[model samples]
Target: MLRAAVIGAGHIAKQHLAAIDAAPGVEAVGVCDLSAALAELTAERFGVTAWETDFRRLLADCRPDAVHITTPAATHLAIAKECLEAGSHVFVEKPIATSLEDLERLAAVAESSGRWLVEDHNYLFNDDVQQLLRLHREGRFGDVLHVEVQVDLPLFAPGSRFVDRHAPHPAMREPLGAVSDFLTHLSYLANAFVGPIRSASCQCRRDSPVATGAISEFKALVDAAFGTALLGVSTGGEIDRFRIRVDGSRLSAEVNLFEVGAILTRTRGGPKPLIPIRNMVGRGFSELRNARRSLSRKLSGGPGPYEGLWRLVAEFYARCDRGEAPPVSLDAIREVGRWVDVITHAACDNATVSERQPEAVGP
Candidate 1:
């Protein structure tokens, strides 16, 4: 079994631990966090042998074959680099690195060290989203004309370290914002289904305390090689929702993340068109409505969707082991890094004007 250590015992770290436990041929050997107490707690809870406040100590002592970096956005680059240097494959959380420069450096380290580096854009692991990608690739939707994506979720509570109260720390604020945090999933989805983006433009606004006047709503128009797409992202709402609509000549497919299912509608150039395909994957929370449903069945069930993500990571490492090509190449990650830079810069500039213009508006 591949021994893995997780860095950062934060909220998302637990989810990573659960996914790691679910993945076959992998074991959690150690855990590290800035808070020694939290690290100890996580290690004890997960039945790990090692725990430490300093990740370097864990790297040297525990000597895990792989490391999962789930720390804050600002610390991703340094931690990932350290892990790579220590001869461990690294799995980093989303928004891979704060800057393109750091991203390039980490890529170089991974290349030189012959270690696998995988970025966790977990949305790609969602079975429904994967099915959508497959159907789009199979041409079930016909020639794609345009794509639209919408994502909105609640933010961390006030005074949380996640929400910066003072001047924006570019690294922390840029990637953690609604546009980068949530909409990047759509961006990745768009790249997966549509072609490479040629050019893009966006307009955004920040309206609430959750985001602390950070950009909460963002709308973007992207020019893809195949066609164009419109992306809309928002937070500061009571609901957590996501939707993707792909329009085509013969049919259309709509996937609702909140509903956990997809619907395909077909049409012909005649009266009374037909709705051909309607497939539902998960229970859609219908089981939650019934008190009789067993919690064990609901929780411990279903082919774990994150298995594919683990497989992807494992394939990356196997490639490294065999001197084969990395599954998600550095070139691809660099391209992603470039797009993230553009989007982050655009959002920052827009937020500055939006903040100032409001005071300039009236008295």
Candidate 2:
């Protein structure tokens, strides 16, 4: 069995631990966190016997074959390096590194250590997304012409660290503030559907007063190898939504990540006058089927919101067992960081230029 451990016993760590448990041939050997209580609680909940307040101690004592780093993005680089150097494969939460330099260094260490390094691009593994990818791969979509992705965040929710009066969340310290936390997801999704980003133009806006100079809205138009992409991220929205739409030569498809639903459009082979009505009925049936499938998944006590995470964790372990490539290739990881870097620079530069514009002097 593959022995795995987890560091950072916070909100996301719970999902990682659960994935570890559900994955076959893998065991949650240890759990670690700065908070001793949180570590113990998480370990106990997962039936793991070893719990440590110090990551070094866990690494030495448990000597796991793999470690999952669910800590804040700022700490990912250091923690991932340590895990790799300790002769353990690493599964790191996204935005594996904030900058290209760190990503390159991390990749080097993983290569030299002969250990796997995988990023938790969980969204790419979502059921709907997986289905969409399969369809694309099968030529159902022909060639992707355009892709659009949008994520609406609830950063201003009561008690969220973004708005914390004291000791705000580490994400609030990122270059893009809380939005950086989700850009990795957007980047990887874009990479998956649109290919390597050739160029991008971004606009940033600060509509919420939560963080000083931190953008609450981000929009980007990108040119890619396969096609064009429009990306959006907003922290000022009242309701959270994650949607991805792709237009192709033969069909168009959209998926609601939060709701786990998908819609596909194509030209129907029928009388031109009747095609519209037939397509509408087909869409209605598609939605109904999606709703039923989602309901069945929920009622069956499936992975729920973290279905993608579970699948990713499981796939990583399986790949390790087979001595195959890591689920998220190092090249893909670096590409994601590059995309984040470009978008961040573009957005920050735009914000700075906007701020520097002289105020109107006219009455």
What would the per-residue lDDT of candidate 1 be over residues 1-363, giving only the tens digit for each residue?
778899999877887777777666778999999898999999898888889999999999989888999887778888998899999988887768777677777887888888878777666656567777787778877788788888866554455444656743333356436466655567776666666666676787767655555666778777776777778876666686787888776667776554455666666434552222222212333334322333432475533434445555556546655667756666666666655555555555543111011112110
TM-scores of all models? 0.80, 0.93
* Residue 167 CA displacement from its true place in model 1, Å: 14
Please write out the lDDT profile of model 2 over residues 1-363, one tens digit for every residue.
Answer: 999999999989999998999999999999999999999999999999999998988999999999999998889888989989999999998778777677778888898899999999999999999988998899888889999989987787778888887878787787788788788888898789888877777888887775667777889888888898888988877886899998998888898787767888886477878877877888999999989987887787777868999999999999999999978898898777777777777776663211121223221
Q: 39, model 1: CA deviation in Å?
A: 0.3
Summed over model 1, clashes come to: 0
lDDT of 1 at 14: 80
Query: Candidate 2: misplaced stretches above 4 Å?
Result: 351-363
- Clash counts per candidate, in order, are 0, 0
